[model samples]
Target: GAGWPGLIEAYRDRVDIPDGARVVTLQEGNTPLVAAPHLSELTGCTVYLKVEGANPTGSFKDRGMTVAITHSLAEGSKAVICASTGNTSASAAAYAARAGLTSAVLVPQGKIALGKLAQAVVHGAKILQVQGNFDDCLELARKTAAEHPVTLVNSVNPVRLEGQKTASFEICDVLGRAPDVHCLPVGNAGNITAYWKGYTEYHGDGLVEQLPRMFGFQAAGAAPLVHGHPVAEPETVATAIRVGSPASWENAVKAKDASGGLFSAVTDEEILSAYRTLASREGVFVEPASASSVAGLLATAADGRLPTGSTVVCTVTGNGLKDPDTALAGMVEVEPLPVDPGAVASALELR
Candidate 1:
């Protein structure tokens, strides 16, 4: 009640919501722009992390879900649907529950992380395990929505981008100007597209004097943007970003071209390395897909593509807790310690 209003209320004038529409929200915006001193030192740039994991649904999807569900409710829709690898389903399920609408999520069979699947199930969403990839699931959802009375809440919906653009506004608002470079994982490519729109709108409004170069990263196994074509079978450890055909392909490419940025693919090993670095070195635990941003930053900086002393912001898109399977991977197995302080100290090597 006495905290940060939701994004729509915070940027009511900027966002395009129908007049008199009842806003559906869960206080999903105003995520922290955390300083990354370790990343800064390593890259020789002023680095910050836009921690979207702090959102209501433990991912950036909540930002868009709010708007999509709100619009669905206003249009008198009793149900919402989407296709997701993980995060979008969780967010849509939650927002739909809040809006008192039935939610249906189409996901690839046996592909989604359990934590995210648990969220959708717990939120009462009808989970359909499609025997296909993410792109196929999306196509099915689109067709179903087109045939039925259900509203599709995917990034293909325009209102979703409107809500997502607020992240860029928050970054600019906190820093008092745009960063020199903004890096983020590009899955369906909606985020990069939305962020580019936000940054350009701010520049047009004279809110900031300059625009940042948009750096979009993808998992090497699923990098259609880098390959200049879609892959038939995308494979990656980072399930959240294992999408071969991005829905916002054209806009994402336009964003990169307009901002003079580049798209590169990071291997799963590189992604995991950055993931561990964020957790162990920087005390910021994020999902593996989120680490693609930091991995890209490190790759670019090491190759001298990122200039020293530049200001950079990397968006970590989802919470590590969203993928417990990946988090527990390679966990050390140890014998049960005796119930004594000495045993703990011995394990910690502090004695």
Candidate 2:
């Protein structure tokens, strides 16, 4: 067996897949769980970053899209549809192209990051920018898929979670056990729900002796779970997480309750600070929404709420390149240097 089999091949003996199905893969799993020394020192807790941006499509959504598209092809579906902030569409479009199925993506108008948008478009997806929020796009996608002969590849599809759950398996395999705590940026809430399910299944089957407490964080302006009500006009600089309502709301709550975890909110300012910190301090660059977990971690640490010396893993969901606009706004530009070596030395103050 060659090393680095895709998730389906890697876990085929453990989980269910379509019978006799050819593995459709972009090698979406087996991301690095890099240690975050600075974060660990600051919080007095051991922290590791689940660098999901290393996935083929530059986001964790590739995990779900792989399974969803594979299942759709096996089921003889000629087309697939999904609603996404950005990453989901890109993944779906790419996979659909591979599977020889049509893909359609519905997105919120003028909201998604340009990099993600470029992926979906280049992959030949039929993109619809609805003049509404993510919730509205999701609703329309579901309705369209139901009324037509198309399969919806959103996280609402069980096959997507089946693929995504493998992330937990990888983590457990690497750690030799589950960490004491797992943190994530919650948008549609499906990720938190899927992770809790994974940990529970592994523990039940004796793969793990313990399970991590699921700590979910959301943008303050779009924190439906934290507020106990959906915000009609959710707004945040973390465009990936600008969801007013979560599809997996009840399941997310269940994960929190079952794991003795809590849902929390982080402001845009805090998210940006964590974004900058991850890049400058830890040399890990991630999108603004992906930094929400780190921001929440620091917030809890500052308030003396985090348990000291505990092992923790934060899922960074997307690449920083996905949202260059947020990373560049208000940053100082470096002036071009002259060709002369002396000019370069002068600019560096080495003279």
Candidate 3:
């Protein structure tokens, strides 16, 4: 009840932790599951936002990072390594710092959001600017971890998914049952894969009556899943999801197929529009990649694909503050008010 004991303690009985292991945490889970009145009205479905941006590091990656870093410490690891577009590195760096371990984050040069980069730096992570993209960084990090003693904490690590699956548990526990549909952004595809695993596990264990369809959306410029192949040079305004070749490709496809969901692409224009709308209308400010879920949901609803009156949850994966430049890119209209009540009233149309 007091701060919720973090996800590891909250779901200790459900997840595995090394015997007598030192726990590293920041109380990352238990994010708000808020109702979206405007989104529901627009889609004709009962819409909700699993606001993962409310996490300690302002992103869902913190959920997995705690467990990954815990395991890294228990395994006698002195350092942790990962390749991240932004959120993952921040999460990893924070957790590793809490655990008193060294962290190295490999990022694609000149492609990361400024806010995310600042998080990594403040958390004491050594940032490596690689010449290639996310996929290349992941490859390099994996290789480095394998050749050295540094532990890799990326989603490729089984423990990362094990930790991420807890999000599904929180959703089901809050709703008293699974929803008809669950939507999220797909980058390296780990989030979708983890959600599917979580839902399926809960269903098998009889925790819920049914599992929801998993809808995954990728940016059009980096929609390798939709293209059915890897794009050597992926490009997108949503840098958090600018992945060319997803490491969890097979599992993501399995999740889509098994859950009777589909993967699709949305353009940057559509993503930004949804991002702005979620902020301006729904009062939910999330990163551009996170808005992809909402974009896909609205698109499918307009196409008569999403059933009316059904329950739907869209996971807003990261905070908009993580990429403020995009939000502040265009001109913002502001009417200057004089130092007078009358002037303020006139500006507010109260006069």
Winner by TM-score = 1
TM-score, every prediction: 0.99, 0.98, 0.96
* RMSD for each of the candidates: 0.8, 1.2, 1.5
lDDT of 1 by residue, 68-133 (tens): 999999899999999999999999999999989999999999999988999999999999999999
**Model 2: per-residue lDDT, tens digit, 1-351?**
367877888888765768987667887899999999999999999999999999989998988888888888888899999999999999999999988889999999999999999999999999999999999999999999989999999999977888888889999999999999999999999889888988999999999999998999999999999999988989999999999989999999999999998899999999999999999999999999999999999998888667998899999999999998998899888889878999888988997
Residue pairs of candidate 2 with colliding backbone atoms? none
Higher TM-score: candidate 1 or 3? Answer: 1
Whole-model lDDT per candidate: 0.96, 0.92, 0.94
In the range 317-339, model 3's lDDT, one tens digit per residue, is: 99999997898899778977778
Off by over 4 Å in 3: 333-351
For residue 176, model 1's alpha carbon misses the true position, in angstroms, by: 0.4
Instruction: Single out the weakest 10-residue window by summed lDDT for candidate 2.
Output: 14-23
Best by lDDT: 1
Q: Give candidate 1 misplaced runs (Cα > 4 Å).
A: none
> Candidate 1 clash total?
0
Which 10 consecutive positions of candidate 1 have the poorest summed lDDT? 13-22
Residue 111 CA error for candidate 3 (Å)?
A: 1.2
Sorting all predicted structures by lDDT, with the top scorer first, yields 1, 3, 2
Model 2 CA deviation exceeding 4 Å by range: none
Q: For model 3, how big is the CA root-mean-square deviation?
A: 1.5
